[model samples]
Target: MVGREGVAVAKWLNSLGFYAFVLVHRFPNSETGAQAPLDDGRRALKIMAESGLAPKGISICGLSSGGHLGAALLSEYPQVWTSPDPEMPQIEFAILGYGPISTNAAGRTIIENKPPLPPKEKQELYDVVQPDVQLRSPAPPVFIVYSNNDPVVPVTNAYRLAEGFTKSGAPVELHIFADAPHGFALDSPKELPVSKWPVMCEAWLKQNNWIE
Candidate 1:
């Protein structure tokens, strides 16, 4: 399941009896921008393995900035976590929301969290934050979702992620909603139909045997 930064969807995962881990380490407090969270994902996954939570494999799901880190965990594992322990669980599945995957500031049509023209440090941050530059081999299957009306993350980000997946011969599913906002499913449980995302997610996981 995916949600905003610090939303703690892991609690719901635990209530369902699935072992869950939340990523609490990152540079900027916000969910968007830069590579600090990718840096944090390494440590988080390491701890998960040390704590015996990610053994055979693990599925990652995220939103916007979190989604970017999720993608980094899968495709750019080499960069994110440099653990000498090759036992790091391979990311089996990833579900991404409106996130900027590979491309960084200079690569995208819409740039975020910066001035009209990016300054030096911000540019350096974007450069290092670009996942496309760090794409590694043997990528895992992915499900990507995006909305055209999302003011924060535009539709192109999803398109680029799919493109990278196909180019690398990785399995991928891209879903586009015509008019949902940036954090459309923020509180989906209170709503109907859309709240069924968890159901759909479970069905998908079961079909793949990721969860029994």
Candidate 2:
């Protein structure tokens, strides 16, 4: 899901002379399905560490499911079994845009308009995965950005996530714009490109000193 986006982002960072590394899966069967983008992010961080690229720390940027993956890295740390990968790169900072965090029981209905899921199957996965972030995990500081006009992932998802972080004593901030739509990075309704989210996103990382 993130290879091309990662490469573009890495290139953007490199243009500013930052050491950016993009992680692509080794072979076929490479899909990071569902919320599995979290694993992909971890693997990328691991690759950087093993290759001695950014051994000590790294910042992560993800959109939609990608953002959810970044959140999962913090909210579900221990349960994540990364096979034989190297030490997990300590996430210094994370930028999440339109991500989902809590996904069961009480919070399932928070999103007023999510695509219908199978009554038993997908909802169970939500129960299994998202709630693991109920303050049980050690989290890095986070930046949550959302567009209130999002037709897909409701803006409330971002608000709820920020609330969870705050309740857990995790430093988190949110930015909500009046007009923007789902997957804005791909196609924005505004005259400007949705890709501009990365501009403020990168600034957020630097503001927190997660990246130089």
Best by lDDT: 1
Question: What TM-score goes with each of the models?
Answer: 0.76, 0.72
RMSD of each candidate?
A: 4.6, 4.5
Local error of candidate 2 at residue 28 (angstroms): 14
lDDT of 1 at 10: 69
Over 1-212, each residue of candidate 1 has an lDDT whose tens digit, in order, gives: 23444355666556556787777754543344444556567667767767776667677777777777777676544444244444456667777777766445664546555342244533445555555445556677777777766666778888888877767667777777676667655455444344555566667667777768
User: Each candidate: what lDDT?
Assistant: 0.63, 0.62
TM-score for candidate 1, residues paired by index: 0.76
Backbone clash count for every predicted candidate, in the order shown: 0, 0
Q: Give lDDT tens digits, candidate 2, residues 1-212.
A: 55445666567777755687655533212243333444555677777667766655676767666665566666644353343443576677666777655643345756655554554433433555562245434666777878887766667778778877777666887888778766665345446545466677678767877567
- Give the Cα-based TM-score of candidate 2 against the true structure: 0.72
Off by over 4 Å in 2: 1-4, 23-40, 77-87, 103-107, 111-124, 135-138, 186-196, 210-212
